[model samples]
Target: MDNSQRIVTIKDIAQELKLSVSTVSRALRDSAEIKLETKMLVKEVAARLHYTPNPIALSLKEKRSKIIGVIVPEIANNFSSNTIAGIEDIAYKKGYHVLIFQSHEKYEREKENVQLLVSRRIDGLIISLANETQCYDHLTDTIDKNIPLVMFDRVCHSINAHKVITNDYFGAYNGVEHLIQQGYHNIALITLPLNLSITQNRLNGYKDAMKKYNLPVRDEWIIHSPIDVVCSEMTIRRILESDNRPDAIFISAERLNIICIKVIKEMGLRIPEDIAIAGFSDNPITPYLAPALTSVKQPTFNVGQKAAELIIELIENNNTTTQYRTIQLDTALDIQASSRRRQ
Candidate 1:
């Protein structure tokens, strides 16, 4: 490339304005050292020249980017999509751009994505960790780098970071309690892997509700299913075909609810007749499903709103004192035919 094609810099702006590099830089940033007239002049000239501040140079000088990185376990899911939209809305309004990355629900993928975003000189990071993530090496890396990070939904307990989550324990407990109240003594829990903290909370809630009501809690009644609809369908089908069929099932996660219904339909079972179901889901589709799925509706919109607010706070505050913050929202059970008692 010719020398004329070289990128513009603060020095170039200084030379054009016949001022020192420090003066030009200060003027560009509107620092108090520069006069109001000089600041306006420098800014106008820089804008006219279409000068773009190099993030690398700015990061080296200012120690942070104005942009925030957002990582989701899977962007395809409704909950993630909605949460991301909320983050974007807040980030954009606060004069920050969001760089979104999908982890595909894999630990290695999540680790790689976090590292890559950090490499891009982001000011802060917001993440909903993957279910498969068990270790905290990558999350701890953020702390070591003095970067502010906030975790939403699936979070790490070992690492002390800011977290925003729904009340999965109460949500699951209330869901199960509602089912028991409706005469569902034999209740099963359709859930994600118990290794995840969110899953464990919901499962604990289930156990607590059963114990409180003096209902039998069978170990085999807990069925862990894959995120895939087909795989979940097959797993639920196996459970349904077993000799010890549950009278009602508490879906631990909303995504698993979709496949559970298909499995119920395949068995030619009448909902609330042969079996009853209640799921943890925040999707609008729940109210429209066949039998209008009774579900534990997570405050999805609020979760998104709060996640964005926390990330914004982290970025603006820039105080990385290793303070652990956890925000837990409430969830409501939407009653429908699935968990209704027989007349």
Candidate 2:
């Protein structure tokens, strides 16, 4: 509680109304023991004094729940699981409990998860928006209720909150530059759906690199696929089988990148010699792939750690405020045989 505004107790209301503490309590509780006029008067005064009866109403004031609620799209993904590890590192060290939930890329499920976490009276919330979530009114509702909310990967910019992400644009640029340095000029970008900031940043990076090198960025070389394996395989097969197939490929999503490798090998194309590749990867098995995949590695665990630190900052702060600042971490390109050509 702020020194300027102390919590209003039933005794204070009783003193103001010239009644006993028990009488004021009964009035505020709507107990049948109290007269209707007395109950109404007490309730009015309680609201006017900014009195809060529960943890949710109090926001981050007196009582701390010491628990953080985390929501993500998929827990099975290597990226998400590693990020959760980072979050747990900070949360447990600070003596806070972590509750995890999955939205499975569905908007309705995501909304339900938020409502459930809020009802549980979590101290703060960290979320990665679902692919299907276009409206942020539900998230804004959480903010309106004075909850501390932070968004990470696949976040919506319309919401005013702290965000943590890797520099996808530069990551993609560096990955493509690796391919260009290896003498692969016709590079195709098989990216995630373009509605997201991460995917769009990566696409722009690829385009800018091609423009800087004076290489043609053809419309046919760009493919948009959601998080579906079937969609990824279909798009990869179509482009790879084309008569004018790219000499190299840049994939934006981890799962999609893995899928592209599978499709390429099945098509009997020699990596680097036929079609080289590089993109974002968190999969540990990438090194063991046939050609040892060249990849732009995101700081998944570090992103989690940073997000935990920021959300805890929001939860523990006495003053209520929203700072729409983004903390961006750099991605490292793991050069390997897939994109590296040795003459």
Candidate 3:
């Protein structure tokens, strides 16, 4: 009020309202300690003056960064990018900042990243487990340290915590069963790190579907590769060139689908003509691909939003070291030209 026109603060509101700073603070925050009339008046005045609380000050007082650290397998992956965007959308609205880290699918890198986030004094964490992350000691340490953690997409089953994940088992099993229905008996599966729960679930789904259909499931039909373009493409090429070629291929991971497409193109094979294909992907471009790829679409954006909501709830309630909840969201099968039977 004494200087140039500027936004209002708690002190300014207190001065105008002729109340104590603490009372004004409580009123503006709608704390139950303040009288209802005072809260309404303070809220009305604060709205008029456009007074916004300084999160930095609150962060310092609370010994929190008001920041949520997000860990992903790779930033460049479509699913990871979209999921992060969803997380940020919610985090920003809740007056939180996100510090993103890429583990590059390495367990050591993931551990180091989590430690760094902890050292930075982040209020909470949201993570998509790395392919190589089998051990949950580092994750368990976060819970022990009283940091709210919400795992999304790829989660560790051993260390139970708030988890938001797609139903990988049903998704992969349905994809393979669809191929079987299309009369493709020789179905092959391409997957990433088998140690992770998502990988295991999808593999199990594939196996169960094969068993239910009485299809031959040879060990050689399951191809494991790094979650990357080069490795997946090479694996796909090897499978294509093998004497025991599969009439259909199922990719458990999204990134592997692109590599499979590239491999099929290189081999001059047509979709659903030379081989039927399906995979797990929520990539927007998936529908636009040549002979639009059939895939299992996870609710990536919803998963991110739900994870943020759960972490914030955990932080607010001071809930730690109790029974954790696992939330599994169902996936959708996108029937497209890639898996359509040649008529």
Candidate 4:
């Protein structure tokens, strides 16, 4: 390519201002050594020329890709999407790029994405575990390599890494307590695979709430539903069809909650009359529904922001992640018509 067609660089800006490349670089970075007037002039000229730093050159010089990798079970979900939006907002301000990958809730796929990100020399990683992930060896390998990593939403507790999560135990406790107060005695808990920490946390919450009110905790009521439409529908139907059908259903997360809502409508069940529904979701769609859903609202944006900040901290400041921090944020119970039992 001819000089005219080449991308403008710091050297171009320096030549345009009749200054050395180092002077232009320091001035652009606003170094104290460079005069304020010189820095101002350099920035004005750089902006006019639309000069952009070459990422490849920057990576080589700084020993960092200036890119952060994000892996989640599914990007299509509103919760995951909001978290990613928060992550990007912070990354952009900090002069870093984001690379996203969806694991599709497959353990193998998550492993492959992690490996690919490492191969690309990502400066850090922020992730949520896939539903089928049983072994955290791939993630352990990442930390063994001293790569900064932060886990959020769906996470493996045994792993030593910075994690951002909602208070699942209390969130579920509040949802179930609300149901009990509404006079729903037979409340079923629909959950993702029991392997997930969230599922277990929510399950315990339901059990504890039932015990608190002197209610029977039926073993059959806790349905371990996967994040699949067909599978969840069939399994949920089986539980509902049973003679011991529940008066209420508290789903573990948004994905399963959506499926449960569809299944309930298909069976022509009335909200809070035939069955009351409550679960975890901060998605706006809940409020717009005919009988707005009762849900536990997690801090999606805050969790994302905190996770990104932690990863960036580990990346830039070389913070020792061995002393891992598990930041558990609060959740709010959004009461609505779905679980508003009649007197």
State, as a TM-score between 0 and 1, how close model 4 is to the true structure: 0.84
For model 2, residues 1-343, the per-residue Cα lDDT tens digits are 6775576676778888899988987777679988898888888888887776655434445467788999998898888999999999999999888999999988999999999998898889999988788888889999998889889988888888899999999999999988888888999998876777788899999999999999999998999876778877998899999999899999888878768888888899888788888879998888898889998898999999999998898888931654568999999999889987735
What's the count of clashing pairs in each model shown? 0, 0, 0, 0
- lDDT tens digits by residue: candidate 3, 1-343: 6565675688888888899999998887679898999998888878888988786677777866778899999998678888888888888898888899999989999999999999888899899988888788999999889889999878877666789988999999999999888788899999887888888899999999999988878888898887667867887898899988899999988778878888899899988888989999878888899989999988888888888888877777775546778888898999998888745
Ordered from best to worst TM-score, the candidate numbers read 1, 4, 3, 2
**Model 3: what TM-score?**
0.81
lDDT of 1: 0.85
Q: Which candidate number maximizes lDDT? A: 4
The residue-by-residue lDDT of candidate 1 on 262-314, one tens digit each, is: 88888899898999999987688877878988988777667777777777777
**Location of the lowest summed lDDT over 10 successive residues in candidate 4:** 315-324
What is residue 298's positional error in candidate 3, in angstroms? 0.6
lDDT of each: 0.85, 0.87, 0.86, 0.90
Flag regions of model 4 displaced more than 4 Å: 1-57, 319-322
lDDT of 4 at 333: 95
TM-score for each of the candidates: 0.86, 0.80, 0.81, 0.84
RMSD of each: 3.3, 10.1, 5.9, 4.5
Q: What is candidate 3's local distance difference test score?
A: 0.86
Better of 1 and 3 by lDDT: 3
| Candidate 2 residue-wise lDDT at 15 | 85
